[model samples]
Target: MQIKHAGCYRVAVVMVLGMLACHTNTRPPVPGWPEHFGFGKTATARQIDSLNISIAPDGKGLPAGSGNAVAGKAIYLAKCAACHGETGAEPTPNRLVATLHDTARTKTIGNYWPYATTVFDYIRRAMPFNAPGSLTDEEVYSLTAFLLYRNEIISDTLQLNAVNLPLIEMPARKYYVNDDRHGGNEVK
Candidate 1:
């Protein structure tokens, strides 16, 4: 009986050790070479900097530059026309302009966007669908101005800049209500 008890103790110890040694995390693999993976390299600062950029609705993250709608027209024709059409009057769902009204607004920039700076931010980060994030700050400002002008929200000669972009209010600004979500046991 003593010998059998000793053998059972040894077996229990071995099982616990085995379980501890084989434990693993169940989450998806991180972006690094695991113990068995030896092919990929760690991400560099430059690569991270270029890819990790976001802009807020209050004109934050806007690059320094200025451009008028007149100049933007040329750039738009060359890079944006394929997707947005020449006059922003395309039959697309998010058409930039045409027959704007309070009840019949088409959700275009002039009608729906609350801040003009958002226009610049979106264009700078993602435009020219084929090649995004390649345009200079000047180009983005120009495009923003052009879109504003096409919707008759701004004059064709008005130059847009970081300083003034945030001040231009959209027609539908009164309709949007900010999210009052706060963390915890409360539901927004």
Candidate 2:
């Protein structure tokens, strides 16, 4: 009985030691960087262009089609009025148009956006806040048209798209100038 008890104790001790040994404090080695970061393959220009829809400030990548402010008003009431309000007043606290105080005082679309193309560009990228990039090109154009019209920047009958978008000049266009500062004691 004593011999059997001693053998059991030895076995239990060995098991515990084995478990302790198995639990090491070492971490695995970090993975090395890839040799070719997946840019060796060339896609067709058409294929690349399909994915790239960014429009420049000069209206470079704008699609064909036009929308008038009158048309835009209906679309705005349907899709945007809930958030941006009936007159872009922002009843829910997201002002799409500037207040009277904002005009000629600070940077609102009506006050300081340099070009109308920016409005179209921004709406094309992000608008309707909750549902971004969901508007059709015509819908975006219409929204831009409506906002511009509401701001009294353009007439309701005016059509807006790529070709005509750049033509609608912003009131604050002349005030902006490039920052000439470089990194030294002064910041650029």
- Best candidate, lDDT: 2
Candidate 2, 35-138: lDDT as tens digits: 44786678775686568776667776677678999999998998888877788855345566763445334346776688788888888788777899899989
TM-score per model over all chains: 0.64, 0.69
Question: 67-87, model 1: which lDDT tens digit per residue?
Answer: 999999999999988878878
Shift in Å, residue 81, candidate 2:
2.3
Q: Please give the CA lDDT of all the candidate structures.
A: 0.76, 0.77
Worst 10 residues of 2 by lDDT: 99-108
Q: What is the lDDT of candidate 1?
A: 0.76
Indicate the residue-level lDDT of 12 in model 2.
86
Number of clashes recorded per candidate: 0, 0
